[model samples]
Target: MAQPTYALIRFQEVGAAKVQTGLLVGDRVLALGEDINTLIRHWDTTEGQLDALAASVDGLTGLAVSDVEVLAPVEPVQVLQAGANYRKHVIDLAAAHRGPGEDEAEVRAKTAAMMDARAGEGTPYFFIGLPTAIASATDDLVLPAYSNSHDWELELAAVIGKEAFRVSPEEALEHVFGYTMVNDITTREYVFRKDMPEIGTDWYRAKNAPGFLPTGPLLLPAKFFGNPQDVQVTLKLNGKAMQDESTHDMIFGVAKLVSEASQIIPLRPGDLVLTGSPAGNGAHWGRLLKDGDVMEGTITGLGTQLIHCKDEEPTESGQQ
Candidate 1:
């Protein structure tokens, strides 16, 4: 049998104590022999075997997707996120932060030039997110009480399949097991530390809130995704389309991110590297997430994620 085009999912049956791995096909999902973690543990040898098994599985025996509660595909050991990788997104942010009386054209020109220089002489910027921040695609997003400018940034995430360290761009893609969608929710206000002017952006507080990184309806195998550089990423907020851009806008593509990341840190199996989001974020729209807002994000071939937004209730300790 040929390799199946599969979407690996983690789901729980009604009243189940633990999650199970499933092979998503059409409207149904078949039970896998083992959990996603087990597969990831042996990915180098098991990927092809799993694909072949999925291809031969009987669809009729599978459970309807609607019958199970879907969870984020994998609980990564590390979540490394790329920042300012989208050209237009960075340019828009730069223009928005320009000094008073600065010419728009000049800002754009300078930003573009800076991007080119970074691409040539500099390296990609990356940050860490705690695994505790991972949330299911269908989960509700709690807008942190501490932030007034909670925002949305939909992006594509690559799932590492093998241990990688100091790998070159030419061989980086081979280390990727699959791809998924990640909505990199941020608190625009917490991004900058007013208390410490000399200190830079505080991604830890801005991005690591519980349920901030809504990920995965499924994880599509890397080989089936073709070139990760050309996929489309779209996000709609409360039925209105907001972000619509191609991965082509990325200053650093998947291979570059993976290779560069390996040089800085060892990427273990099941680690995730989120390519930066494109333009059309809530910051650009001048509208932050509010109670009852619904964000739907999709990346070509990886599937879509619908996240509901709600305000976190304040406790006596004021901790959410």
Candidate 2:
């Protein structure tokens, strides 16, 4: 048996606009940039090409991966997210958005209240946004004018290395390539209040803002983290740390989240599952993103993504 190879990426140079690819084999990283795309085109969407390229690095010369700068590995077509997947986030959301009978019923209806509380707030939540929203690992995020409630959620996103559908949670591990950090940027004021059908309506306008998602540094392979559930996760704005928690706090663990996503759609190679964020999201503080703010997030094995904010015009009130 041979040692498994890994894919790594980085920017071409300081202030470069695009990310380039490389293969991590042993201590050396092989640059695959154009070669990767050429092989993909020739393979016609086959995985064997990637496998071979990953294996062939031993013979490649100056094209070593280590020689290249590291950046986020994949530019995913979609980023799926779980809103309010942390317990503390649930509490914060409840307090921030609480209304009339919501508090009074808390005392008399313990069990019902518990179930009802999560109705609009929790459950295995998920949503998808265009890949174009992703920013390079070192890029700056732009805040649109329409967004008054811009917020950040630190999430561990698993990158799919293979195609899978109707897979069991137990078998979900086989399809994973690796994990990366995602700041599941959001327009809190735009998302519908919990389970409302209106949530779907907001996807187009709310989450699709360019550079809305800041992902990567590199995709740390699944082997890096023996047990995903035990990893610590954190989010920071500017220099102050706001979210400090762990994957153990997730309401739906990685396998379950992957299994559920696979059941609904054909999760193709390179797709991403942003495994939700911890409590202390920006919304809870009544402080949303402002121009010039810097945001950064990290998970146990995955590297960090740091984003500086850029001011921009927001969509008009009825533009969606």
Candidate 3:
């Protein structure tokens, strides 16, 4: 079988003759070119056409990915992310609870018990992240100064293809434009703050730091990555494979995710529902990020994203 292909939007310079990536795809970005700013201003209705344009831009002039800065694909009218979806990560964590030096027999018994608890799992767990928190490919992520439990989650994000509401799961893919790799990095302490256990009121602050959500590499059309369940997703921290799993473990896949969200809340074009991250998150092991740590992650067919954490500094343009 041939590998899946996607339309990658990127930045481009005005006088440059070679094709280039744009600063933003669904949203306006000045560095990407005037076309992006115009698109961002009208993203509400132009998203479908934009995906088509991006996918169809073959044999073009004045744009090469090398020439421009790459940004997140969608400015995102809204964002939804899932929690505890990977089966292996869930299983591994449960095994660890048996305590050190426990007999192998105890490990197997505890694993079975954990699986039973997941039976009849309800609606997919989801929380919103700020659109302003989104960053582009190659952008630097700022570690929160106030918190120390910062972490990373690698997952697949689905982009809405067209306007949709109350659609059946079987017909849901029709509303999908494509897919992208997303890093749903979080501050664990902030996310599960002792003060607020409820997700709705507290999650935004926990997950919405300036560069909490780093996405892109470009949009992989849904037709290319058929059966979202079968795709393989893996992540490595500083050259070690920490997260390796498949979307097959998702308790709720993309089709259902779209259908459920739309039944009550209207899902518009360019809205993003980041399918939940699989287990192996640093937090589960107390392996929080330290300064200068480099992490790389990827989803099959969606491409890869690399993130590095370092000490903060003032920008030349006066950004702190």
Candidate 4:
């Protein structure tokens, strides 16, 4: 197998402001050699051109990776997230919230049966996230002071390369450009609506806080990242392992997610489809995020990300 091609956005200091969007290759970083937005606007055609430039050193003097700050590789136009897509995770939650006097084994059996039925007949559930909530891999996460149930959910994100509309699962993989990692942080208390019981889940406020979604230390091209279905997602909090599972546990895999998302809305290049997180969330461990906590997430072949957690400072208005 050939070496994987990885791309990143490096920041350079000039005067008082920092210049963003420098391309990174190995230890060296260089200018886009073309308009950054234009390159992504025509990603399918321009990626090859960018790759060619990265391969040559002629006339270009690049900077070292250690000297430059790194940022998120893509600024997505839209972010679509899958929910309740991991079998083990669903089963765990069901068992945790079992009815009074209910047997644990019985609950597991029933949950497994329901999951099987959904896999065979039901469609995958998806929700929208804001691009403004996205942060860089090494950025600090701000835990809202109002909610004490802040949680971590490490997920594998698929980067879209081509426009897709009502595409079939059989042909959906072709629309994928690459894979990256995202830590989908959430405030568990805001997930439900207490005032209106029938209003259903409120994912918007629960998952879209500023710096909630930290993405991409590197973007590994799809052709080089190998099988997305088999990648391992491992997360450690403060040097102790918390989430350790593989993408194989996903009830709905990448192709099914892409196909389902396209059926709802046309997916454009630079858009992201984040497959749901596996079991081992903070709720299960009974250990929510606290100030000064650190989270490290790693996906096989894709790089690792370190995020420092802190409380959101109180404003003069006293609102969180």
> Best-fitting candidate, measured by TM-score?
1
Between 2 and 3, whose TM-score is larger?
3
lDDT of 2 by residue, 1-320 (tens): 57465545544644565555655655556555453333223334534655676665555543544345555567676567766566656666666566766773463345345535664454477888788888776787878877668888778888776777989989997887677787778887676655577545476666778877777876666765568888988778898889889788676778888888888888876778988778887777768899899877777766677788877754576452
Query: What order do you get sorting by lDDT, best first?
Result: 1, 4, 3, 2
Question: Per-residue lDDT tens digits of candidate 4, residues 142-183?
Answer: 898889999999999998888889999999989987888999
- Stretch of 10 with least lDDT, candidate 1: 52-61
Q: How accurate is candidate 3 locally (lDDT)?
A: 0.70
Q: What's the CA RMSD for each of the models? A: 1.7, 5.7, 5.8, 2.3
Query: Candidate 3: where is the Cα deviation over 4 Å?
Result: 1-6, 12-60, 96-121, 196-201, 313-320
The lDDT leader among the candidates is 1
lDDT against the true structure, per candidate, is 0.90, 0.70, 0.70, 0.86
Minimum summed lDDT over a 10-residue window in model 3 is located at 23-32
The residue ranges of model 4 lying beyond 4 angstroms of the native Cα positions read 1-4, 10-19, 34-37, 57-61, 317-320
Q: Which of candidates 3 and 4 is the stronger one according to TM-score?
A: 4
Query: Model 1 compared with the native: what TM-score?
Result: 0.95
Instruction: Flag regions of model 2 displaced more than 4 Å.
Output: 1-7, 13-19, 24-29, 33-71, 100-123, 193-201, 313-320
Please state the error at residue 50 of candidate 3 in Å.
9.4
Q: Give every collision pair in model 2.
A: 9-71, 10-70, 10-71, 29-64, 29-65, 29-66, 30-65, 145-313, 145-314, 146-314
lDDT of 1 by residue, 130-156 (tens): 999999999999887776799999999
